[model samples]
Target: MLVTGGLGFVGSHVCVALAEAGYDIVALDNLANARLSVLARLREIAGRRISFVRADVRDGRALAQVFRRRPVAAVLHFAGLKAVHESVAQPLEYYDTNVGGTLTLLRAMRQHDVRRLVFSSSCTVYGAPESLPLTETHPLRPANPYGRTKMIAEGLIADCAAAWPELKYALLRYFNPVGAHPSGRIGEDPLGVPNNLFPYIAQVAVGRRAKLNVWGGDYDTQDGTGVRDYIHVMDLAAGHVAALARLESQPESFTVNLGTGRGYSVLEVVKTFERVCGRPIPYEIRERRAGDLAQSWADATLAERLLGWRARYGLEDMCRDAWRWQSLNPDGYPERPVSAAETRRRRSRRRS
Candidate 1:
């Protein structure tokens, strides 16, 4: 199987799960938003060496070469820019990487007669939920470019499936994926600044950052802050396995939500992190950013019924695992190990 962006947070965990399930993994990544060292860690956890392809999914020739060389059973496309604020600032890049790259991949898959795919979609496609627990049939009114790209990709996959009658696809729309592998050797490593809440709280707990900025404290929620359905990375990865099994058994296209069907406010997360890390997570209530929602959770009934999968971890597990990664790797995979030369380069880049 081919796994794009297999070195990333969710992607890496999926690779580990897939490897344990006895799948031969060909991991393709550009390392733009991930680190090369992550592949080593994945090998360590997976207990086997995986084939690594250092190529971008947007490069048609490079992607085609992989298909030409091997008989890929299926493709798990996870290579894309996924920052909400960054997507707003650079809409074209996001579209080119997310939408355009997906198109390139689909064409290559079609060329090679590989008609099976497991796409990494997001719950952002739901926008603000019309009701409490969002189902797969919920209206897709994405409010941001990030979500728009996902919706577009889903449409493209559907079109591709229609064209190729044998094509099987599973679009797994995930909620907030937090936590790390229990081994603590691999985790989420966002470039520059993190756009998610858990990483920011982990940073504060680890003393890498000053405090957490609780965005939007005036929303109509339990704590007047935005509430999100945070699912553990492992649980989310297992859901992918289940989805793959379903796709293999029945060659049909489907979309499902992978979430715990529970919501937690910002304060709730911070307090949980404090309990997990044994450090007070100092935070400030800031203004609510535009396009933010009040509360969003999933109706996981479809996943449970179809894939026979349900999220098992809660807020405490998420915080504890994330804290383990943050505390162990506060610097988050530095290029060089705290040497004077590395320090000078970091300082120089900051000044520039």
Candidate 2:
């Protein structure tokens, strides 16, 4: 299998799942927002070396090279710019990487006769939701450029599937993915500021960051804060495996919401973090973030009915594993280690 952006936060966890499930992983990542040190950790957790390719999904030639080297049965395309705030500032880059990258990858797959894909989509496609427990049939009205890009990519995949009857695609619209591998060796190590709440709170607990910024504590919820369906990253990873198995069995395209069918408020998460880490998470309520939804969880009925998959981890598991990862790598991952081949090549160039 070929997994684009497989070294990223959720992608890395999926790599561990795929590897442990006895699948030979051919992972492609540009390290644009990830770490190569993660590769070592992935190996540690996976108990085997994963073939790595340092390349972007937008480059067709680079993608084709990866395909030439391996007979990929399917692809899990997680390669995209995903920050809602960043997407607002850089819509072009978001569209280019997220939409254009999927186009380039699909074309390459068609050429290679690899027609199966598991796309990473977002619940932001629901756009503040007309009702609670967003379902797959819910109208798609993306609020941010990042969400817009995912909507566009899903459309493109749907169109491609319509044109080719043999194409099998699974569009997984995920809610907030939290937690880390149980091993704690591989987890979310975001570059710069984190857009998600899990990493932000973990950083605060680890003392790397000063305090957590609670975005808008005036919403109507259990604690006057937003509530979301935060699925554990490992459960989310297993959902991908389930989707892959389904696609391999049937020659059809489908979409599902991968979530826990439960909601947790921001203050609830902070309290959970405090309980798990045994530390006070200092926080100051700030203005609501733009494009922020007050409450949104998943129905997740279709995912369970079709894929036979449902999230197993709850808030406590999420908090405990996240704290483990944060304590282990308080400063995030170390600098990328140099491979022996890369070191030798540099030395030879210097000698000449």
Candidate 3:
């Protein structure tokens, strides 16, 4: 199996899960927002070396070469820029990487006769949910460029499946993925500042950041802070493996949600982390982010019914595991020099 962005937070965890499931894995990444050292850590945890290719997903030539070199039975697409605020600032880059990358990948898959795909989609696609406990049937009305790109990519996959009836895909629309591997060997290590609550809080707890910024304290939630469905990364990773298994066994293509089906408020999370880490997470109420919704959780019934997957971790487990990773790796991943190839790619992107 081929796992794009396989060294990233969610992708890396899923890679471990896939490896444990007896799949020979090829992990492809540009290392744009991940560390090369994670390859070693993954080897240590999975007890096997995962083949890696360092290339951008938007590079069709590179993708084609990967297909030609390996017998990839299926692909778990997780490559793309994911920051909501960053996408608000840079829409074109988001579209080019997320939507354009998906197009390039689908074409390569079609060319290679690899029909199975498990897309790493987001609940952001169902922006500003009209109803609570969002289901797969919820209308997609993405409010931000990041969300828009994912929605567009999901459409692209659906269109390809319609055109090529042999294609089988699963669109796993998950909520906020938090925590880390229970082993604490690998975890979410976002570049620079974190845009999500879990990492930001973890950083603060680990003394990497002075304090956590709690966005919006005037929301309609019980705590007056934004509420979200936070699923453990391990649970999220298992969900992907399950989705892939379903796709391989069944001829039907489907879309489902992967989440805990319960929402956690900002203050509530901080309190839980404080108890787990035995430290005070200093936080200040700030203005709400531009593309954020007040509260949104998942129904996740379809995921359980169809894929036989449901989140098993609670908020306390999330905090405990995240604190373990952050406390162990005080400064996230180690800094490494940019390769000549990566430098060239950046320059080319700048010129284009």
Please report, in order, the local distance difference test score of every candidate based on alpha carbons.
0.90, 0.92, 0.92
Pairs with backbone N, CA or C atoms under 3 Å apart (clashes), candidate 2:
none
Q: lDDT per residue, candidate 2, 311-338, as tens digits?
A: 9999999999999999998988887544
Candidate 1 lDDT tens digits, 72-114: 9999999998998889999999999999999999999998899
Task: Please say which candidate is ahead in lDDT: 1 or 2.
Answer: 2
RMSD to true structure for each model, in Å: 4.9, 2.3, 3.8
Clash count for each candidate, listed in order shown:
0, 0, 0
Model 2 spans with C-alpha error above 4 angstroms: 336-352
TM for every model, in the order presented, reads 0.94, 0.96, 0.95
Off by over 4 Å in 3: 342-352
- In terms of lDDT, the poorest run of 10 residues in model 1 is 334-343
Candidate 2, poorest ten consecutive residues by summed lDDT: 335-344
Candidate no. 3 TM-score: 0.95
lDDT of 2 at 69: 83
Tens digit per residue, CA lDDT, model 3, 63-100: 99999997989999999999888898899999999999
Q: In candidate 3, what residue range of length 10 has the lowest lDDT sum?
A: 334-343
